[model samples]
Target: MESSLLTCKKKISKKCHVPRIGTSLSHFEPKKRLIVGTKPNIPDLNLELPSDSEEEEKDASDDVPKLLNELEVEIFARVSCFEYWKLQFLNKQFSQLLKSGEIFKVKRERELVKPYVLMLTSGNSRWTMVDKSFKNFRRLPEVPSDICFLYCDKETISAGTQLIVVGKEVESIVVWRYELELHKWTKGPSMITPRVMYGSASHGTDAFFAGGIKFVEKGIPKVCTEAEKYNANTKTWTMICEMHKRRKFCSGCFLRGKIYVIGGRYENGKNLTCGESYDEVKNSWTLIPNMLKDITFKSSQSPPLIAVVNDNLYLLETSSNELRVYDVNENAWKRQGVVPVKANEASGWGVAFKSIGDRLLVIGASPLPRSFIKRMAVYTCRPSPYVEEQVWEETENCYDGVELSNFIHNCCVMFA
Candidate 1:
């Protein structure tokens, strides 16, 4: 265990000054509440960073350049996802650049993006929004789902978002759409093939739900090869091709332009080592060349969390609590870095993970002497071969008031 990153959160007194944007230790915890901020909240999607006091401004100017050009702003904007949200407070110029989507445009053109984690944790089954600091949190509507079936985060460059939520309902699987921009929930088309614990991934504009254990008897079930695709725009689902292997409690990731269905267990209490990819152009599924067997260096009770970052596939091995990177071009696996110890300790039940911008965001719990504490860990994923150079920053003691049994159902990262 790394004691350097694990410690109690410091509580601030009344009338304390706000910390600077991008400050690592900016998180503040009060008596029974987690403060989002003492500053004014953003009315719309165009959020402004907290204002700096005069003395703080003087200190910043003395240490760093006062003015930033467009290129400099772009460079700073690409640095941190949570911090990037706070950087909007730097100046009027910085505020305008972010509000006008100029910074995001530069990032998209340069292939740079900052991801914000939208997580679903089980405290009475509620939702909350937090910035990079992870100290401040705002409550949102609960996603109307019982069993986590399929969930995904999608964003539009114009500044809005949606989280597609799906789950099992008695004899069928229900679909619900949560529009982030409107903060409203509406029922969507249900799955043609009702499935639970299925391998799902959203590619392009459609959501795909694949292999899962189909309910036949009261308790005993059978692995399924059936799959379907749901179009968010049309609010309709069209049956798609089946996968090469049947899987349940599996993981799916969209890479390049195809969907890869990774490791999951079947009815025989055995996990599938081989994986496959679906190509819409060919309307078929092709074997992925024993991708899971080649890379699974640890034993995971459930399927590992798989994601695609910068054309490469990354997996979080829950058992070993290590992050591994796989280059699609090289078709080889290598050690990237270890997940934060706090997040690893929380993975005893399961961990929620997603790729935000260039970093990997993980949400898990740290067991304490009396109870458990939920925490979020962020890691920078560099495109370099030197893995040791990467950095991991954690935001612990989040959702402190929530009960520990509120296990994570699902989590996704969205960018506005």
Candidate 2:
């Protein structure tokens, strides 16, 4: 299975085109600083020169005129994070401020953060970061790992400003993180128990990973129940309590202030209908049996397609292309409506389903007639379980003319 996926990825990469970073503030000409007046040739002999300390103070105040440095940072924090890259070109101070990630910290404290979608499309080695509007996007630097890691099946999740990609190399499983502030990919800070096909979800600066397959002696695969938490701020992973049942190909989400892992097969190759919820304060997992009992299972289908928006858990039924909302109190799923995308195709493979802020975002091949040529379709809807039909709005011209494959290898949303 892994070898076949790697071969498919290799073929896709060959046909992909790496998009250049989009232009920002490029049209406007630089405003030349004006010289109001020339210095006088004759100096007053009695005039006392300013002290070194006084000169330094004056320069510091001039850094942000009429505002203290803290106030300047506060102002910048309120601005959309997508425009932050352009701010670096303003001056060295702005560049330093962005690189320091101080604005992001301020935005978090002030509750001014916004979600940006990061996607690794099929045939594209580099990841693309797109704003919530999907109007502006920039290509991220390619991961610096070897071809083995590059073409292998990978899982992506975002914690704070870090985008973490977990995959297998020739010798071992590797963790590669793309730091938004640094705008670079760095390796290490791997999971406590390195594994793949695990369920992962991010909350604030911390991300949780649980229940994946790990290789034992001589490449023998074994299902694992071990769970771990990754703190992006500290760049560290801490072991958490294991789940009741061992699982692989499970899906995870942060809902109702808890991390929920749902629907994956056990080591014995039997599908699991139960779900588990982890409580950080109690440091335990609560097993919820038949969490996915309503949904039909397929042997060759991808892991459960799920996302959370407004603390409501939603599942995309791949067999029917229908959307269902989980009722926490009732412990059952409520059918919303059919998704516009062709999720049923390929058994939910090559599709990106995620929550972007208040809206549920779905990217895949459109079921519409014009989708015959394989043009990727992007749609978003404000999902409400109370409503019978979901009104999905297609985000036209959002791809910036780049031909992206409908097959999304990995996708995650980073709120920074």
Candidate 3:
């Protein structure tokens, strides 16, 4: 029997794309204003003649200042990413200004861009996204049917507004790219080799995939050593240098322009303590020291989820719900605080972590007395040697039919 038992497996597995409404800022497209013609192309609407006073009021509303001053622009740049998308929809001038990169520049200069954690989980071919606040959510379009049942050992990365997801169905692997600006999901170049439980990381518009099981031969699945990268602009995959060792269920992050693959598991069922860093420019993989040799982890514990914040890598443990910061200067992992919510006893299989702005977003399922519930929370980790107590503030919860099982295969961070 498969580990994941789906309630809608028979009905959904054979179906294809089903359109759904969702939120994505998408690229700047000129809004098509309503045209009032006697014979309209879209004839379904009941067009009525407007009164003279109504027309005059509409003109006055349009005459309201369509542009913002320097100070006003600065103030508007502080709006949250979600609100910014909605504002653009209301005014074409706002859309044009936002697309010009002027607002992002001013925000960067003023240091006002706040990061909000975006959480995603899927079951029965439906993908749902929610922010840390839980007050806002967007139901993404239905996932592709080919890999709809392929729900375990998945990986995700964010390149700008695009969310890249890699997962496998049987021996074949599929790559799905979700465009935040366009609110669309498009297929990308699949890996040359099929694999599961691989490590992935993204920098800019490119992504790297490494170290997973290719396929089962002679009743045993072989761990992979070859690595590949995906170029978002070209929508193609390129082979990269092989790693020094084989790894699966590993944690990865792109820091300082280099790809780092941390601890994973081998075929023998023993966890790997060593790690490796891949230098894309150098076209070589450098073996990193055994950072986990001194640390202790349970037998069932998978590798921690890694996220880059201010050029430093942080790890979020699923077993203990603890956060650790890696100091490259000191070559040690500093103990941080624990997440406010506890994870399900399944060794944190449903938990995920991502670094948004200066805070860390942890999303997962917390085991209750008779059931499990979903939670989205944020925590602040300071850089100073001495820091204050950190708490995970719960923003969202699930009380409906949303499954609390290992539905969330992976989570990632993307800058809007």
Q: Highest TM-score, which number? A: 2
Cα error, candidate 3, residue 109 (Å): 12
Candidate 2 residue-wise lDDT, 1-416, digit = tens: 33553465455444332222342233111111122345534657999997985454332213333244465577778887667778777668878878888889999999999999999989999999988888888999989999999898999999999999999988899999999888899998777899999899999999999999988899888999999999988999999999999999999999989999999999877889999999999999999999999998888878999999998999899999999999999999999888999888889888899999899999998787963738878999999879988999999747657877888999999998
**Candidate 3 TM-score versus the reference:** 0.67
TM-scores for candidates 1 onward, in order: 0.62, 0.83, 0.67
lDDT of 1: 0.59
Model 3 lDDT tens row, 1-416: 11222323333433312212341223111111333435455644577876885454342223224322343466566766567667777778667776665665676567665444444554535555655454555556765636443545566776645677777655466777886545668876677775768888887668888998877666467888889987765677889999998988887888887999988887787788888899988999998777666456678876656778778787766666667777776667777777654553557566666776666666654444434354333334444324534555544454254543334565666555
Q: Which stretches of candidate 2 lie over 4 Å from their true place?
A: 1-67, 370-373
lDDT of 1 by residue, 1-416 (tens): 11311221111211124544654342323311333556654357565655674234322323323232443555654565445445556566656655554555566567665345565665445555565445545555865554443232211111124466666554455666765434556675666876667877875346777898666666556789998887754667788888877788777878888988888886676777778889988889997765767544334465667767676777777667677787666666677667664444544344666665555566665433324344333333443444643466655536567433335656665553
**What ranges in model 1 sit over 4 Å off?**
1-114, 131-136, 143-160, 216-220, 294-300, 342-348, 366-389, 396-407
lDDT of 3: 0.64
lDDT for model 2, please: 0.85
Better of 2 and 3 by TM-score: 2
Q: Residue 280 of candidate 2: its Cα lDDT?
A: 99
> TM-score of the candidate numbered 1?
0.62
